[model samples]
Target chain A: MKKLMITLLAALVAVVTVSAEVPAGVKGKKLRMALVKEWGTGTHMIMHINGAKSEAAKYGIDLSVIDANHNLAKMAEGIENAVINKMDAILISHGKADALTGAVKKALQAGIPVIVFDNDFAVDEKTANGKLVSMDQYDLMMGLLSQMALVQALDGKGNVIYNRVANVPPTDKRHRIWEGAILPTYTGIKVVNTIDLGTSNPMPKAQTALETLLTTSNNIDAVYAVWDEYAKGFYNAIVASGKKIPLFSVDISDQDLAMMQTHPEVWKASAAVNPSLVGRVQIRLALKALAGERIPRYYSMTPILVKSADLPKERVSMKDLAKLYPAWGSSDAFVEPWMSTLKK
Target chain B: MRQEERRLTTKKLDIFGFFYKYGTILVTIGALLYFSLTLDNFLNFNNVTNIFRSVSIVALIGLAITISLTIDGFDLSVGATAGFAAVIAAKFMVIWGYGVVPAVIAPLLVGVVIGLFNAFLIIKIGIQDMLATLSMMFLLTGISVTFQDGSAIYNFMPIPGGGIAEHTMSKAFLAIGQGKWLGIPIPVYVMLVVALLVHIFLNYTKYGRYLYMIGGNQEAAKLSGIKINRYKLIAYVMSGFLSALAGVVLAARLGSGEVDAGAPYLMDGVAAAFVGFSVLGTGKPNAFGTLLGALLMGILLNGLVMMSFPYYSQDIVKGIVLLLALGLTYYKMKHKG
Candidate 1:
C-alpha cells in the first residue's frame, strides 16, 4: 500500500509538471485570430508572419493576415473588420499609434484580446480593460548591444562612420539609445561621417556614398550601421577598398548571416531578435488573454548578440540559429498551462 | 531717332539671347569652380570620376525621358519599368540560376514588351501618354512586387515558400556596374557611349528628324506623310530599352535586386531632362543637354555631401537649382513671345 501510494504521487506530479490541462471554456473550441500588419513585404515581416501562422495552427485557430501595404487607411479598416467579425484575438504590427488607437479601443471594448508588435498604442489598462498587450523587438537593447560591441572592439576610441534612417519608430528608439546613452558615455569615439541616403534601395546608394567618402578621407576607423541594410553596403565598400574596418549593426536575416559569415573579419557583430519568435509570442499572448489569463500591458522580446567569430564555418540559415544560440529561435515568455492541451 | 531706338532694341535682344544660350553652362561651370576652390579634394581625379559614376544611372534614365520628350510624350512609367527590369534580372540570375547574358538581355526584352504595351494603350486605345504611362507605372510596380513576392533578391537569400537561392550574382554581371578601364568606372564609360549614340541619333538621323517634327507639329507631320504613330512607337520603345539598361546597371551596382529601387531615379531623371531644355538654349530635350543636366546635379549633390550638409535640406537645394534652370528657360521664352 505504501509503495503504491508513492507511485501514485509520483505519477500525479509528472502529469502536473509535464502537461497542461485545457481550460474548460476553450477546450476543443475553434478560435479565429487576425493579424493586421502595416506592411508585410520584407524578410523579417515574412518570418514574423510565418511564426504567427505556425503558432495559430498549433491551436487550430483560423489566422488571417491582412497586409496594409503601408497604407494607414487599410490598416484601420483591417482592425474595424476584425472587430465586426468578432475575432477571438487580434494582432497588430508596425502602425502609427494615433491612426490605430480608436480602432484598438473598439476592439478592446468589444472584448477581443489585442496584441501589438513594434507599435505602441495609447490604450492602456483603463482603455483596454486589461485585454491589450503591446510588445516590441527590444530595439533599445539591440542598439545598446551593437554599439557596445563597436565600442569594445575599438577600445572606445576611433573615428566611425555612422548610418541612420531617421523618423522610423524602431530606428528612432535605437538612435535615442545611441544619442542619449552611448555617445555621451563613450567620449573617445568620434563620428567622422554620417550617411543617410533615404532611398528604397539604400545598398547601392550607400555603397556609392561610402566609396566617395573613402576617396576623400582615410580617417575612418570603424562603421556603425543602425540597420543591417546599411551595414551590407558598408561591408561591400570596405571589401572593395581592401580596408579592415570592422562593422557593427542591428537586425539580422539569412542574407545578413551569409554576409557576416563570409566576411567575419569585417562584419564583426549584430544584435537581433528572431522575428519568427516575435510572431509566435504575439499569438501566444493573445491566446492567453482569450483564456481569461491576465497579461502584462507591455512585453519585450530579449535580443541576442550574434558575433561573426561565433558563427560556424559552413553556411547556415535562421533555422540553424538555435543550434548556435539556444535562446534564438524559441521563447517561453507567454506560454500558458493550457497551451499544452492545444492541438498541434 | 527711330533708327537709334531700333539699334538699342537689337543690341538688348542680342544680350538676352547670349545669356539664354549660355546661362545653364555658365552656372554649371560656376558651381564646379566654386566647389573646386572651396572644398578639399573636390577636384581630385577620383572625386570627378565618382561624380560621373554616381550620375551615370540617372543620366541613362534621363536619356529615356529625353527620347520621350522628342516625340512630345511623357513616360511616367520609365522608373517603374526600370525597377521591374531590375527585379526580373535579379530573378533570372538568383532565382533561375542563369548566366549574365540571359539576365541582362532578358530584362531588356521585357522592357521592349512593356514599351509595346504602352504604345498600344497610348496610340490604339487613344489614351493620353501621361495617363497611359502613369497606369503602366502602377501596373509594373505591382507586377514586380508580385513577381518577387515583395522581397529583395540577394545572394544566399531564402525564397518565400522554402529552400535557399543558391546562385549568386556573377562577376561579369557586377563588372558592368563596378568595373573600370583606364581608371574610369565602367558605368561612366557606358553612359558616355550611350549619350554619344543618343546625341548622334537625335541630331543626325532622318528618323530622329521625323520624330522631332511630329513632336513640334503632329498634324503637320501627318500631313507631310511622316508616320506619326510609328515614330511615337519607336520613341517609347527606345525609352523602355534605356530605362531597362539603367535598371540592369543599378542591380549590378548594389549586387542585389531590391524592389522599387528605381523609383527614386524618376524625379531626378525628369529634373535632368527639364534642366537640359535650357542648356545652350536648346529649348528641348537633347542627349548632350540631358547628360550636362545630370552632371550639374551630381556636382551640386557631391559638393553638398562633402560639406556635410544635412540630407533632408539637400533636396531643397536641388529644387532651387531646378527652379532656377527652368525659370531661366521659361522667362526667355515668355520674353521672346
Candidate 2:
C-alpha cells in the first residue's frame, strides 16, 4: 500500500512539472534572474525588473527572480540560488562591484551567463566569464553631463558650490565630474565651496549649508546633486533661502518629472536614464546568448535630459509596468507604481 | 592672627575644586575662542545663526537622554522614537487632512503611550532598561514603516486655509523650526525653557531629591521609603515624551518625514550625557551641563565641517572627544575626597 501511494505522488509531481510552458524563443528552457536593490532609484528598479519578466515571457523563458534588497550577502545568496537552480542568465544592477564578485565567478563556473546592469568592479571591461553586458559606467556619463550643465548655467563663469555626499560611489563620480571635467572647461566658474552633507539627514544639512552659502557668495549660479533626493534637498534649501539657483542631478523620479512639468522654476533640468530599458535589454541579450547568438560584450544606454516640457505624454501605470518591462514588474513589484520606486 | 586666618583659607582650596567650579563654562569659552581664531567663517552672523539652528534638534535629544541617564537608566530607542513620531506626524497632517495642532499632538501622544509601555516592561516585567529600550527601538522602526507604507509622505501643496498668499503652514511651521525672537532661534528658546523646567524639577523639588538618591544608591533610597520603580518609570516616560517632541520639531523643520531620519542623534545624545559628567566636575547628569555638552558637540561638528574635514572623519573626532570627556570624569571621580 505504501509503494502504491509513493508511485501515485511521483506521477503527480512529474505531470505538474511538465504542465508549465517552456519560455518561447529559447530551446525549451527556463531562465533565472537576480536583482540588486539600489535604494533611491525607487520605481525605476521595478521597471527594470518588469522589463526582464516581460522579455522572458516573450522568449519562452522561465525567469526566477531574486532580490538582493541592497545587501551584498543577500545578493551573493541570490547568485548562488540561480547557479544551483541551473539558470540560463543572471542580471545584476549593482552599485558596488566588490560585493557581487564571488557569486558572479561561481555562476560563471556553473556555465551561467551574467549580465550586470548599472555597475561592476572589474577594470578589464569583462564579466566573470569574459562576457560584458555593460562597458561604461553611468557615473562617467552623469559626471560629464553634470559638468556641462553647470558650465552652461554659470555662463562659463561664476562660483560653483558642490554639495557632495560622503562614503557613496556615485557621489564620488560626480565629484570627479566636477573636478576633472567641469572645472577645467570654465576656469571662471571657480568652485568656491564644497559641502559634505554627510551620508544621513542630508536635506537639513544642505539647507543649513545653503543658508550659509547665500551669505558667503552672491556669485553662486549652479549646484550639482548626485541623486534626486539630494538634489531636491539642495533645491529646497535654495528655494527656502529664496536664491535663484540651477540644480541638476543623475536619476529622475515620477515626482521629479511631475514637479518639472508644473514647477519648472524650481528645478532647471535632470539627466534621466531608464533602468527599465536596461533590464529589458539585459534579459534579451541573455536570451540571445542562450540561443547561441553573438551579443555585444558591452551595451550602453545613453543618458537623456528629461526637462519640464518633455514629460512623457503616455505614462505607464504601476501595475502594467511589468508588462512594459517583464523582469522588473513581476513578484511583489506590482503596486502604486506611478511614484514609489521598486529597487530599494 | 588675621594673616594666619587668611592663609589657612587659601591653603584649603585645591586644584580639583577650582577646575570643577569652572569646567563647563571654561570649555565653552575655550571652544568659542579656538574656533574664532582658526575658522574663517566662525564669527560671521550667518554662520552663527546656522550653527544655533542646527544645534536645536541635538539639544532636544540631549534633554531626552538626560532624563534617562539621571536615573542611571539608558534609552537606545530615543532616536528611533523620534523618527517614528516624525513619520506619524507627517502622515496625519499631510495625508489625512488633520489640523497642524492635532498632527503635532498625535505624535507626542503616541510617544507618551510608548513611554508608558516602556515603563511597564521595565517596572512591571523587570526587564533591564537598555535591553527593553533596544527592543522598543526595533518595534517602533517596524511600526513607522508600516504606518507610512514604507514610503516617504511628501506634502508640497499649499494649505487650503491660506490667508497671507503664502504657505500659511509653511510660515507658521517655519516659526517653530526657523523663526527667531530677538535673534535667538525658536527651537533654542524651546530648549531653554525645557532646560530650566527640568533643572528645577530635578534639583529643587523633594521628588527630585528622591530621584537623585535613587540613582546614587537604589537600595538605600528604597529603604528610605522611596518608590524606586515609579520614579524610574517616570524618568523613562519623560525621555519618551521629549524624544517625541524633538521628532515633531524635526518634522516641522524638514517639512517631510524620512524613514532614516533621526539616526545621527542616537550617538549625539549619548555623547551629550557623557559630556555633562565632565562639566563642572558634576560627575552626574545636570541640565546646564547637558546643554553645554550638546552645544559643545554641535560647535565641534559645525567647526570641523567648516574646516573642510569629511563627515565620516568628524564621527571619529566625536568619539575621541567623548572618550576624553569620560577620562576627565574618571580622573575627577578617582581623586574626589
TM-score of each model, in listed order = 0.91, 0.81
Question: Taking the tens digit of each residue's C-alpha lDDT, what string does model 1 give over B1-337?
Answer: 9999999999988987887899779989999999989988889998899999999999999999999999999999999999888888899999899999999999999999989999999999999999999999999988998898877888878776777788989999988888889999899999999999999999999988998898899999999999888999999999999999999998888777876888888999999999999999988889999999999989988887777665677789789878988997898878876
For candidate 1, write residues A1-344 as lDDT tens digits: 67436534543553466657665435567899999999887677889999999988988989999999778889999999999998989999988888888999999999888899988877656778878887888999999999999999999999988887787778788889989998999999998878876635667667777877877887888998888878878888887777888999999988788888879999999999999999999998887676655688888899999999999987777778899999996899978755876764
Q: Candidate 2 DockQ score?
A: 0.28
Clash numbers, per candidate: 0, 24
Task: Please write out the lDDT profile of model 2 over residues A139-184, one tens digit for every residue.
Answer: 6676677568667766788766676665566567667777776677
Q: What's model 1's overall lDDT?
A: 0.87
For each of the candidates, the C-alpha root-mean-square deviation to the true structure, in angstroms, is 5.7, 8.5
lDDT of residue B189 for candidate 1? 94
* Candidate 1 docking classification: acceptable
Q: Provide the TM-score, chain A, model 2.
A: 0.74
| Model 2 chain B weakest 10-residue run by lDDT | B159-168
Give the 10-residue window scoring lowest on summed lDDT in candidate 1 chain A: A6-15
* Candidate 2 lDDT tens digits, B185-232: 787788888889888988898867777888899899999999998898
**CAPRI verdict (incorrect, acceptable, medium, high) for model 2:** acceptable
